[model samples]
Target: MTFRHAADPVAVTADNWIHTSVLVLNASYEALDEIAADRAVVLIIGGAAEAIADRESYFAIRSTRVEVPLPQTIRLRRYVYIEHVPHGGDQSRATLAGVLRRDRHRCGYCAGWARTVDHIRPRSRGGPNTWDNLVACCVACNTAKADHTPEEVGMRLLWQPKAPTHRAKQQRKIWRQLAAGHA
Candidate 1:
């Protein structure tokens, strides 16, 4: 079923409110991870968790016997032990969107708004798509630097490209449970 979630001036009609995100917190008020709305509701109903913060807009989900306010944040009654997992290393393969996000969509050559990724080493010369070799480039710079290294074209990189830092450990998952395929 759908829910009318007023995002702003535009009302976003989501296909499934059950899939909406709810922040899950440990008993000590430590943020754990995001979980599905349905699971959060189950936790609240089963007395495993309680709603710490309700949705900004007053909305209630009703059952035959109870009406629980939809939550933006929920806290568990018992502390959950979560372990950190290594997200990725510096040598990880890079994608176009990832490159743009890493560089904030600014041209590596001119620091202008960018929408394309350029290879420091041209692909024709066997440059693999890796984080350290890719940088965001604007249309003009990309076209001008076509098939040529920046030095050969007298252009300079604004910053050295590198893989993005990993997210905080707790945001990933329970390492042991995930490794054993139980989480």
Candidate 2:
């Protein structure tokens, strides 16, 4: 469903279509090419970019209190560029769900049914939730390991999860769209 700012002067009607997951990029900053709208909100909320003022009035929605997408490009507190990062083999970012699927839902430990996730290094011990440190785990194995380090628990991982050398997630999405069209 499309959402609009409560304070918007112009109403968004049936003619205007909205799509989620629109990508935003850093135009000046030497960072990754793009991020999702949700992440863009974080950057805006964090004072990284001023909403492109020229486009604000034309946005699909407007709320004085909350952040809304500007209809026009806004200048970043630093230069920011917004672009649709196409899905392809070279892209680095992959969704959590995609990572889990790549691992085939198998616990690095026991290899039984896995529905949960485990950190190779416990978070309490300072593990960040990146793809390399995460693995699909069964409930039983997770409970068995608990908050302790793997060495402390005497458990061993069957495979070391690594970041993909090539971006498979984008390829997968393209495949899905292609398959859907054929169907």
Best by lDDT: 1
Q: What TM-score fits each model?
A: 0.49, 0.46
Reference-based lDDT, each prediction: 0.76, 0.57
Instruction: Give me the runs in candidate 2 sitting further than 4 Å from their true place.
Output: 1-96
Give Cα distance to truth, residue 95, candidate 2, Å.
4.8
Candidate 1 clash figure, as a count: 0
Per TM-score, the best of the predicted structures is 1
Alpha-carbon shift of residue 177 in model 2 (angstroms): 2.3
TM-score of 2: 0.46
lDDT of 1 at 11: 23
- lDDT tens digits by residue: candidate 2, 39-146: 345446556554443233344443366746633333345442234555423345445575668688888889987888888788899987777778888999999998
